[model samples]
Target: MSAWIAAAGQALLIALLAPIVTGVTRAVRARLEGRAGGRIAQPWRDIRKLLRKPPTSPEGAGVFFSAAPVVLMSTSLLIAATVPFVSTAGIAGSADLIVVVGLLLLGTVALALAGLDTGTAFGGMGSSREMTIAALVEPTLLLAVFALSTRVGTTNLGVIVAAGASDPAAVFTPASLLAFAALAIATLAETARIPVDNPSTHLELTMVHEAMILEYSGRDLALVEWASAMRLAILLGLLANLFAPWGVATGTTWTAVVIAAAVLTVKMCGLATLLAAAEVYAAKLRLFRVPELLAGSFAMALLAVLTSYILA
Candidate 1:
């Protein structure tokens, strides 16, 4: 019961904090570009306004169109629940890292299907680009996961973090460092961030994710947007907790839990700043060049795995 409560609280905390992270990243990017951006509270306001409006389905849209956003949001929540934020323990019993990756893919697949269902040129184009990117991303993501899992001798996320927490230096090896780099790149691609797919772009030819949901409006759009934010937060949290799980609480004591939460928040903010800085200085790659980026990430993952074997 205690575990259940902790898991619920942590999941809720993530959902609530996700928007703030998105807002901060946006504000930071704007500031770097010499513009006075909207306040950090802007995302919350946008979501609330969106929620008050009615959702409109695209012409010829089927039930899948309506269901896709819900599935995406649910999968994001599931991913959040599986990750260890405040504690190494999670609510789900089979919350393996592979399962987490699979869920992330599932959400992407659903969104792609929804895009195709809309039968618009932009939607089809986005779906094609998205699937192409996904094809290159999943293998790299899996390889990175295998690198870490092989080192820890377990696929369960909680166990991996707990093990890393036990021996923090073990995560500083060549394999670990390489895996982190690979996963970090994969995260940028997976989240539709700049240099892969710019989140702020509306150019139909360049948009990957935005084109898919271009027809969605009102509450559905809000949910999709919120879910996107949560997914980003969860992925960065996973990267942080997996590679730097030193401060994560392994016990159920209140003081430990509080300290764990505080550390997690700091890590997230630091990562957000890094991402914003990277985005500010980076230009979005041409659609064709994205495959090369993913290929490089895959090579990194391959090296990380090889290093893990040689060092082990």
Candidate 2:
């Protein structure tokens, strides 16, 4: 009972803090570029303003077009609920890493469908690019999971984290390092960040993600934006806890949970700051070049898998 409550609380916490983490990244990037950026509350303000406006849909839109934002947001929440963020435990049967990977792909597919449903050129283009990237990233993501899971003999996220927590030094091995690199690239691509895609750009010619949401307005746009932030938070949290599960709480006690939450915050902030710094210095790759980068990441993940097998 307590574990379930803790899992719920962790999900709610991720949902709430997700936007703030995004805002922090924006602010840090702005400062690095010598501009006084929007406040840390900017994302929240944007969401609230969008929600207050009336939602608009395209002519001849179907149920999927209208429900896409809800599906994206719900899937992000579902992923958060199942992953080991503050604690290693979640609702029974949903805590498996394979299930988490499936949920991530589901969110991607849902967005791609919504993009295609609009029937606009930009929508079609974005959907094509997103699906292309998904095809390349998903396999690497699964292989990275396989790299880590092979060592522990379980695909359950809780067990993986428990194993890492018990032996933190084991996470520094060649296989884990390669998997981390692959996962980091996938995270950047999945979250629509730089070198693969730029989240801040609205230029349709160069934009991949923003192009898809071009037709969304008001509350629908709010949900999509919020979901994007949540997805970024969830992925970064997983990278932090799974690769370095040292500070996460294995038990569901209040004291342990509190400490776990604090440590997770620091870890997340560190990763977000590092990512922002990277984005500030790096330029977005041409759309044609994205596949090359993803292919390289896939190769790295394949190597990680082989390394894990040989080491075992």
Candidate 3:
């Protein structure tokens, strides 16, 4: 029962904090570009307004179009529950690394199918680009995680983090450093950041994730947008907790839990700020250039795995 409560709390926290992360990124980007940004709560406001509006399914669209948002949001919540943020006691057994990756891919596929169901040119185009990126990105993500799993001898996320925490120096080793780099690149690509796909842009030709949901309005759009933000937060949180694992609680002590929560928040803010800074300075790559980025990430993962084996 305690474990269930902790997992539920973490899920709620992810949903609420996700928008703030996105807002912080936008605010930082605006400041860098010499413009005044909207309020930090602007995303929350946008979502609230969107939910108040009526949803309109385009002509010829099927039930999948309506079903996509629910599935996406549910999947994101599930991933959030599985990732250890403040405590590992609740979720360690149920969510292995591979299962987390699979959940993310499943969300991507559902969104892509929703895009296709709309039968719009922009939707189809976005679906194609999204799937292409997914195909390239997932293998790199898996390989990077596999590198860490190999060193720790478990594909379980919680165990990997526990092992790393037991030996802090493990994160500074060659294999770990390389894996972090690879995961960082995968993060940028997975979150549809600049140099991969511009999150702020709605241009059909360049948009990958956003273009797919162009037809959704009202509550459906709100749900999808909120889910995307939650997914980003979950991924960033996992990267921080898994790699650092300094303050995260292994037991259920209140003090340890509080410290873990605080550390996770600080880490997330730092990562979000870094992402904003990168987006401000970076240009979006051409569609054809995406494969090169993924390929480089793949090489980094492979290197990490090899380094781990050689060092061991």
Candidate 4:
């Protein structure tokens, strides 16, 4: 298969699987808590219902408010198109670490700006908190990936993953373990998961992501929610492939691509299951203590970098 075809396939697969991944987490959490969760397709139903409604904007909301959802969705689609989830043969030169990181940041900033544009106290407060956490989160994301880049000798995600596939031992090293831990924590913060921010919480004081989107309604809200789900799926996909790329496609065979896609789904669902279990046992840290958690992740990422360099 051509790289472009592979990329398109990967994007579509991720898009379709994003909602299911979210539902899996919620259902798993519900099961662990002794409640029968709704169907695994509940997120898809909620999104479809939201899309059928008309979008409403807050009074005095400007371009940022109207444009943020599109911007967020577009950035996510772009990342999904470029990132090699199923096949390592991504768009030529499009999966650079800096570029992917920048895309993630762009979506993040767009949402933050939208939150601020609402002129609500909660919006501003959430934006402030998001930026603070982002300041710490972004660096750890880079450093954790940087640790892998050192061993691969390039910052391209496709290259790093391909290298991991060829040398499985390298992926199981001390450096890889530290980087995985750091990225795992950063993913939790980025996705507003437990121990960072509670996705199901409605309490104003406890809400982080929900606060920013409180003013959104209808299709605008749908886009934001869809994009958030996609972001979580993408990050989990990244985590799965980065540390355990055993089944990722490295060739141009269509069969390999199909098998790889199946493998990506399995990995993402497995990770989501583990994440839900962790959330069940984990309590949300206090607002003031969030930075300390991020600090610990950052330290691990830094050490991963140093460890990779020294080991090399």
Superposition error at 12 for model 2 (Å):
0.5
Alpha carbon lDDT at 280, candidate 2: 97
Error of model 2, residue 213, in angstroms = 0.6
Worst 10 residues of 3 by lDDT: 86-95
Candidate 4: lDDT over CA atoms?
0.90
lDDT of 1 by residue, 75-154 (tens): 99877765777787646323787788898999999999999999999999999999999999888888887787787788
Cα lDDT for residue 131, candidate 3: 95
Question: Model 1 Cα RMSD, Å?
Answer: 1.3
Candidate 2 TM-score, true structure as reference: 0.97
The all-Cα superposition gives candidate 3 an RMSD in Å to the true structure of 1.3
Cα lDDT tens digits, model 4, 71-118, are 999989889988878877748225988888898999989989999999
Better of 3 and 4 by lDDT: 4
Stretches of candidate 3 off by over 4 Å are 170-172
**Stretch of 10 with least lDDT, candidate 2:** 89-98
lDDT of 1 at 147: 83
Q: How well does model 1 score by local distance difference test?
A: 0.87
Best by lDDT: 4
In every candidate, how many clashes are there? 0, 0, 0, 0
lDDT of each: 0.87, 0.87, 0.86, 0.90
- Name the lDDT of candidate 3: 0.86
